[model samples]
Target: MLYRIFTDKEAFEEALYSYQTNLSIILAALLLMPFNYLMEVFKWQLSIKSLTYLPFKQATAGVLSGVSLGFVTPHAVGDYFAKIWSFSHEDRKKALGPILVARMSQMIPTLAFGAVAFIVFIQRKPVFDDYSSDYTSWLIPVAGLIAFLLLSFLFIKYGVKNKKWMYYFDLIRKLQLKSVAQLVALSSVRYFIFSVQFMLLLSIFSFPISFQQQFLGIAFMFLAKSVLPTFNFFNDLGIREFSAVLYFETFDISAAPVILASLLLWLINIALPALIGLFFVPQFKIDPS
Candidate 1:
């Protein structure tokens, strides 16, 4: 992705010039990385508390390990195993429940905020004017609703009958309303941190949009990226750039800054943590016995 972007020599040069002058903004974005992941660690700590008491140090290590492994796997499925492996064999199955809860808590804000952003995005006549009459747009919502209902029916009728599946249902039942609310609150904080980091990176690149426009563009980009399917190899590479460019081009903003900001945000939030997590990766060992 970097190579592709750098191929456009003009964009590359502009980004470098921006970086040299806005060094402090770059530093600020980097500083937020710890707090972003720290929020995740706290979410992890709270999520697993229902099943086992994970100390702060161990939770931090486990969360980092999950990030490292998740970097290499589709949809970050490796994250679930990483957290589960942190427990004894006896507790591993139970751990799945909390791991899922932690994941869902994080996703709720993305979906909720993304839904609103999508609605607002479509209302922008400059972008959605042509698509206003398109039937395909209506098809997407109808299809989604049908699929959701079908899946819910199948899960209720068949999934609940499986003994192994009961673990997750039971775990959900065990969680109090307060704990669930706390998980959502912590996840919201993490989401806000990353969003601010993206905005900071944009400012560093001198994006010429108003604050509201920038926030809307960022929110829309995140929503599009989150809802789309991605293989692990391509997860952080192209989707974000495409989404940002697609949204901001309407405002006559240059693609260079938008693309660079998205890429830099990925580096600070995802790539950097994955590098730190490499240290803890070797410590995770699965027992076959």
Candidate 2:
């Protein structure tokens, strides 16, 4: 995939020169990488504190290990399991709820911003004018949102009440409203940091789009990548590139720089952390006994 993009010697040189000239910008984006994971670590600490006390160092290891494992698993399901194993064997079962809550904290910002971005993308793009005019075109996102909310309400109101699910719900019930709010706030900040990092990378590639357009494009891309299911075999390799290229193409943006930027973002945000997580993988004790 990447070989095809870099095959254009001219485009590759241009990107290389751009990175050289904008070294500060590139560094700034890279710097945010740690802070992004730091936010996640904090969220993990907060989420699991209800069940057990997790020091910052251990939480950091657990979060990165989750990232490492999640990188290869479909929908990052391995993320949940990795974090759950961060606990002692006895607390692992109850750890499920907090892990979920931690994930949901980050998801809220993505969905909220993504929904807004989706609406804006469709509205602003002339290609979507026909779909926008047709009322039915709006049904997909709206229906999805409604169904998500309905299911969430049902789970909190009824699903947790079932005795069979008490093991999972017990830790969730222990979370204070204040703590949940903190998680949301931290997630929002983390989302903003990574989103800005992406925009910074795009700027390095000289995308020529306004801040508004870049933001809308990035948000929509994240939303698409999040909601769409990827095959386990693919491990989410091409999804971001596909989403970014698809959105930016409407702006007459070339696929080369966009793809490069997306790939770099993945390298900084996902691949690097996943590599770092390899060290922590040994720390995860699978057997409580």
Candidate 3:
């Protein structure tokens, strides 16, 4: 028998390798996109609550303007400025509040995923007996914590740092606690769902990795982005690929299929969102003066 002729170890490896070549996982990852899109809507909901009691249409416009700008500018700074400008047209201070909060919602899950992945990376390394002195890998979580604390302090102390409490400060106060908590919670939910996107890519290729491992893999990808903020052009493509390669090496995971999976996820996760922004030609009623 072929099974008897081949050693059991060899037989298992053959089965594993063969199993890794199927497409079921990619289909699963694709299912995550709608969840990601729905997560965006929650941000819209929070933004609406943070604004000047405007109807959903106006707040939606502000959200669209923010996203549209995020698409055009390097690193999505354009979206931040666009939101500020769009909201300022109605209530500059109030509009700025949610725009600020929206960013917090966006990053929480990114950092959370990265933190867990870093832990997994460390654990996964001893299995291979291949070690690198990049202890700086540990810095991602530390820096993220420091940065989050610093920003939170600033938002709490100086978000309305001026005495115009009635106009901006008080309104910002109303949003400060709830918005931050919601964004953080929402971001975590978003990350879990987004991992499904990655799973789909691997499923397409018949890769046999767990969703949790995929999450850690994807987390490391994002962590690498935070580690090197200056290589701004494709928003961490090289960093992401390098990180993926690093993780893949641990499982004796081949480079080609992993790279393929990473690239496909990137296309789905980033490029698609930017493309969606193109359809957001909003009509705002801000004065021409």
Report, for every candidate in turn, its global Cα lDDT versus the true structure: 0.74, 0.78, 0.60
Per-prediction tally of clashes: 0, 0, 12
Specify the highest-TM-score model's number.
2
Off by over 4 Å in 3: 1-28, 53-68, 84-89, 123-171, 205-210, 282-289
lDDT of 1 at 279: 91
Worst 10 residues of 1 by lDDT: 149-158
lDDT comparing candidate 1 with the true structure: 0.74
lDDT of 3 by residue, 1-289 (tens): 2233234465446545644665455555656765775666667567546454545554455555555666556666766555554443456545555555566666666776677677768777431233454445556665776488547735654565556644644444666655667766776777767666665565544446666676678778777776666524544566676778688667666555566667667666666665665455455334444
Once fitted onto the true fold, the runs of candidate 2 whose alpha carbons sit more than 4 angstroms away are 1-9, 125-154, 157-159, 232-235
TM-score of 3: 0.69
lDDT tens digits, residue span 12-36, model 1: 6877798789989989999999999
Give model 1's TM-score versus the native structure: 0.83
RMSD of each: 4.8, 3.9, 8.4
- Work out the TM-score per prediction: 0.83, 0.85, 0.69
